[model samples]
Target: MELVKIYECLCDPTRLRLLHVLAQGPVCVCHFQAVLGEPQVKISKHLAYLRARGLVGSERQGNWVIYALPAKPSRELQANLACLQDCARGNPVFKRDLARLKQIEPSCAWVRAGEPQKAPGQCRGG
Candidate 1:
């Protein structure tokens, strides 16, 4: 029952989309806001929910906070995510998001390579 509650958190489309992006690798909060085209407050809210559910992990790097999937998700979680990935593969929005992420390259400070333009504003909480 407790696990079910956590799984339910993943049911939200926005959170699911965020999960898909995080699965690729860690992403900066600003980059996520840019890609989702959502307000920073909304993105922050959803991110907080995802983190509380233990579906994602975050790290702070300088002024940016980057998010990523767990290195070793439980078998059940991993299986479910695999299915979600397949279903999202053909989604136009998902494709566009991926493309945008590629273009941005290293938008998150923790990103390993590629210099990204530092977005203006104080870094928000991850």
Candidate 2:
């Protein structure tokens, strides 16, 4: 019912890709667009949907807005996402997006420690 709606919101390929990236750490909106190779408006729309469903969170850092998953997702939600991550890992689109992410910036506190620095031009915002 209500939970199904949440899953539905995440069913889109673009949104699912967004979630996978956010799972790594907080990312700026511009960075997301660059990494995903999608238009800004499209990325924004998907982000709005994710926000409405309470599956993600956002913060403003300087002029950039960064997004991430909840610090403490419910156990069920975490388990569901873990399964989804496995499926997404083998996706070509996800792999390309991940490669792009690595080229954009150095890993930050938002990202997991020990992640490699991204190359330049992968993200647009600071």
Q: Best-fitting candidate, measured by lDDT? A: 2
**Per-residue lDDT value at 101 in model 2:** 86
- For model 2, the superposed segments whose C-alpha errors exceed 4 Å read 107-126
Residue-wise C-alpha lDDT for candidate 1, range 26-92, written one tens digit per residue? 8888888877878889888899898887788888766677788888887777887888789888899
Cα TM-score per model: 0.82, 0.82
**Model 1 deviation from the true structure expressed as Cα RMSD, one decimal place:** 4.3
Where is the poorest 10-residue window by lDDT in model 1?
117-126
TM-score, candidate number 2:
0.82
lDDT of 1: 0.76
Which pairs of residues collide in candidate 1? Answer: none
